[model samples]
Target: MDIGKQIKTLRLGKALTQTGMAEILGVSKSTMSNYERNISTPDPDTLRKIASYFDVTVDYLFNDMTDSPRDIIKEGTAYHPDKALNKDEWNAISYYRRLSDEQKDFIKGQMIQLYQKSSSSNKG
Candidate 1:
């Protein structure tokens, strides 16, 4: 199944209207509709929000697994032809992709600070 179909199926299963999901994801209703209809793809951040709202993993959203949904969850990680992006990582990648060159430089600076902080914490 396509990502759009999977998203639509999951949304319908959860009894959520497109508008409702759009509101939660801070996107336009039309954008949500586009995603469901496969007219446009969701940026990674939006994909993460959708996965989080539906309590599913990114792999489950992108793959066609015949096994139980619970088993998919228990498996933790699975490869999908689609980008293998978990929620937060997807959001970060999406944000980076949308940045201008100057903005990307700023982001790199910020990441350097964060990485330094993390490394220092590990040493303590």
Candidate 2:
């Protein structure tokens, strides 16, 4: 199912009104309605919040799974993806993706050196 449909189904399964979800998510009721109706996609932070609230992964939110949306609740918890990446990590990734190839190579080398230094220090 599409993300909007999935969100609507999850909301209905939990018996939560759009207003209640908006309040909890710190968005306007109309914004919540837009999300359910697929008028707009949630930003990364809000997407993370929704996944965390439903105890599902960000990948689950993006993927089309079972024919039945309710199956998400039953199987969702079982399919845990990696722990949610934090804002700083996500920002770092976004910055990395925007870099030129040379910049990326430099950054990657720097990261590897940092990692090796930190690892050796920890062993010592």
lDDT of all predictions = 0.75, 0.76
Flag regions of model 2 displaced more than 4 Å. Answer: 69-124
lDDT for each residue of candidate 2 in 88-119, tens digit (9 for 90 to 100):
66447646866899999999999999999999
Worst 10 residues of 2 by lDDT: 66-75
lDDT for position 7 in model 1: 89
Candidate 1 all-Cα RMSD: 10.5
Candidate 1 ranges beyond 4 A from true positions: 65-124
In TM-score terms, which candidate is top? 2
At residue 121, candidate 2 shows an lDDT of 100
Q: After superposition, how far is residue 53 of candidate 2 from its true place, in Å?
A: 0.4
Taking all chains together, the TM-score of candidate 2 against the true structure is 0.53
C-alpha lDDT of candidate 2 relative to the true structure: 0.76
